[model samples]
Target chain A: MLTPEHIRDFLDEVKDPEIPVLSLNDLGVITGIEVAEDGFVTVRMTPTFAGCPAMEYMRAEVEQSLKRHGVQAFTVQMSFSEPWNSNKISEKGRKALKEFGLAPPQPYQGILVLDILEYAECPNCHSTNTEMRTPFGPTLCRSMHFCLNCRQLFEQFKPL
Target chain B: MLENAIKDLLYKIADDQLILGHRNSEWTGFGPMLEEDIAFSSMAQDKLGHSLAFYTLLHQMGEGDPDTVAFMRNADQFHNSQLVELPIGEYDFSLIRHFLYDNAEILRFESLSQSTNEEIAKIATKLKGEVRYHVLHANTLVKQLGSATQESISRLQQSLEYALPFALGIFEPSKHEQELIDAGIYSGEAALQNQWLERISAVLEKTHLKLPEIANLQPVYGGRYGQHTEHLQPLLDEMAEVFKIDPTAEW
Candidate 1:
């Protein structure tokens, strides 16, 4: 008698392997869910990046979560037709990212401008007085920033 | 004939991505700044993933499994361009190579997105979006550093000159080039090279750096046919070091 809502609720407990604080639902990676009368469940997902190493781990976690919820046959399907963008990240996810010591993604403006440093508030001190250390970060979606106020170096999830 | 041609094209593309992705990943802990570290790592992951996708296609076409093909290949068996296997010397050198290589790669992916081969075209379409950011990152840095201070500009110029010959080798024609072109699987290295030249020239024009007169320059070829610099075998050895230990043990 498990419904799609119950499956979604179960998935909400599945945290992103890289950013453990954010659930897959919070990150907007889970695109769709279906529950069949025969207790089969299907989840459609998209990766934050085409090559995100965490993807396989996340898929396993999704299946584990659903199976734990007593679903008999389930499948997790990865889709790329829609393409992923940072804009898909929820507001709650942004707040979680900030609280976790990484600056959240800013609103993406069309065409990357070099001046994005001006708006990167420090996750450590919440100060706008930050300098960009590098436009590229340790991961595809992150950038390095230095807070002049707190003197702490932090990573920012760059807006896509 | 077309099958061999297609496999040749896929192997070269996959090998290039795999080797260069490994090189980019080497910057993880050593970037001058954390953002660059992450940027390279991000691009590295994307490149590696792209290689995996192509390898998967090869597997479907009856090649060996992806893990065996990627981790167990000898240096002579690899088909990556020599440019990718070169050591990442300095930020200047890596950045210049990034600019040169990605310009060509983005163009290649764009053309491949329209390939008559549906599978290749689909993968290309998915991958091209990811590479767009890599191109942006490369072009932005090249423009900034290529025109900035005396030190930065001079360093970039030096690296550009040193990397150019190897970069040109990326366009070394495949023996199956005509077959690939005629089959609409790819438009051929010559066409891609021409497009790459225009693209890189457009970016370089915005900077103080000058493009070397490529007409007189001899490309460092042979990589397409498996001849590599001494640097490559060592790199391959290092890559296989951990994988060879257990081949079956999952981390």
Candidate 2:
């Protein structure tokens, strides 16, 4: 019989596909989990959006992670009542993302936020003059920019 | 269609999205599970964004800026169909609303793609991508919930009883409905309604749910006409408090 601690350990290892440095729990995406008396587990998660492309993969990962801990008959439930925001992302997750070569989101204030967006500072060269001619970037999250210094095209996550 | 009439058309479409998006945003963090909470929140945000884009086009046409288009306008100027304004009753009702609106929007964008108005066509091109995802998500829920346990089916049935009339409001014609159709900017309201019903009926059939004998509510035309529901007033009050305080304040 697997313990909840074992379950936690297994889940801790599943990294977010986009930001591989942080676990989903650290991202604050895994909002709730219930371990029933009979070992039936239900995981509650809010996606970044209703139409988020990552949902199927994330759900499967959660199920497989728990099953590895010997929990079966699990259900994954989704809700939109409270809405997910960048605010839900943990400071630790943000730090992890920055450390992993992705820029973490800048905090939101009522006014005067000097957030990244004049040009995405290049990940490779850390140049500030990179500009994206195209709004739709390489991926949904990141836009492709040409580093004037390096002359190499790279991707940066776009602000919402 | 006359430019003014197109502006009214634009307002109806954008307002429906803005109000519905706001209502859906209310569900964030309160869902039965966490993943759904995030998914719903994302959808709400997308709707707000899409509305902003559409309203920006109107602002360029001299109607109002995005913020004013959304928050400052009186309810009578909104012109949103009633479907987008009604309070969400329950999860099933919410799902039903999605089932109706998502597909309708997909069709609306498709029609707009061939619009005579260049700006409208260009905007429709971008919206197609987002609306397609909404259709897929809503359809997936309709199927899953239909095939779900008895409790889910019962709740969905109950949801249908209240939501169908409001859902029908998606087709409530605005003043420019015929002009839009004549100008090849969009299909007429009746045609959209028929297609909406057929699509909605097909999905509901799979859910093993009973369709309520609903009288399509005479849509209260406040959203398109800028005569909004009571809910909208407070919502505007909350969202626009900052912008209202200083029109020059940059968000």
Candidate 3:
């Protein structure tokens, strides 16, 4: 009999299709796990955004991971009710994101301000002397920054 | 009758999102700054996702699959506004257009959230939150750049004037507009535009930019009836380029 702990362990290996560096658990997308009396498993999750394209792939990957572990019946249920926040990302995920060359998200203060430049340390040189290039980066969660010390351009995962 | 009106409404909204999303994605890796590159790409993904949602609704109504409908449509077949199909010119132009378009879009989604059709209403309600952020992003940039240096202010002012005529096309009334309004599917584009003007003017009031005289300028219409600028065909060609080559391939 596969325990819920075993299922969680299996899911921890399922990385996000977009980021790839962080697992679903690391990103805090996995909200609930239910094992029915009839041996059916239900995994509840929420997307980082309502229209995140990677969501379909994430659902499929979860089902595949559970099946690979010899689970006979499983389903991935998606919900937008709880909604996702950047604060859900684990400390391990933040370190991994930084190591992967993408600045991790900071805690948002609920005000729309361009002050991320003041606190965004350059992932390349660890220098605080950086300037924001644009608040609108290549993706919804990122913003661009320039390091004055290293003269390297980098993307900061915007605090949401 | 209601079905036809609903489909028409869905097509225009979906087409606008798909085309603008493609345009926004082009900014990826080429943004003046990494943050902007990411921002455009992020909004691009959101726009694409929103289009997919609407297309899925159409698919459920017996249209072709979302991929086929989105990837196979030609420029003449698309129903987007002329404003979204224009090439994202300079940063100032893109920013100004974003300001104008998203203002109307947020209002559109808010109105649609009350749609009599349950599915459309649910989708709109969920999407309204995302569009709110887009409006926030556009408003913030417009405010900052609008009042910044003389160069920035002048550039934005020029782009604002250039974009207004086309922006009006977003409210070009559909043929079935009356049916849609009667059925309570949407409140119609005219009402949406009135609300949009007030909302956009409020933001412009805080900036150095000025709103153009709408009564004097001719609105560029015909996109809803399938006529489009020459720019749209090339954009469609580029968008379907890869999809056409291997429509069966999964990657």
**Top DockQ hit:** 1
How far off is residue B164 in model 2, in Å? 1.1
DockQ of each: 0.43, 0.02, 0.34
On a 0 to 1 TM-score scale, where does candidate 1 land against the true structure? 0.85
Which segments of model 3 are wrong by more than 4 Å? Answer: A1-46, A50-53, A74-139, A142-160
How many residue pairs clash in all the candidates, one count each?
7, 43, 16
Across A1-160, the per-residue lDDT of candidate 2 in tens digits comes to: 5455566567778777866887877766676677788877777876554334566578788888877766768888754333354556778877786577665544554421223333466666777776653323323444345779888876554443
Docking category of candidate 1: acceptable
Q: What's the TM-score, to 2 decimals, of chain B in model 3?
A: 0.98
Compose the digit string of candidate 2's lDDT tens values, residues B208-237.
Answer: 887665453444334455555576667667
In candidate 2, which residue ranges exceed 4 Å CA deviation? A1-160, B213-223, B246-251
Ranked by TM-score, the better of candidates 2 and 3 is 3
- Each model's TM-score? 0.85, 0.60, 0.78
For all candidates listed, what's the TM-score of chain B alone? 0.99, 0.90, 0.98
> Of the pair 1 and 3, which is ahead by DockQ?
1
Model 1 agreement with the true structure over B101-201: per-residue lDDT tens digits: 99999899989999999888878876876787788789989999888999999999999999999999999999999989999998899999999999999
| Candidate 1 global lDDT | 0.87
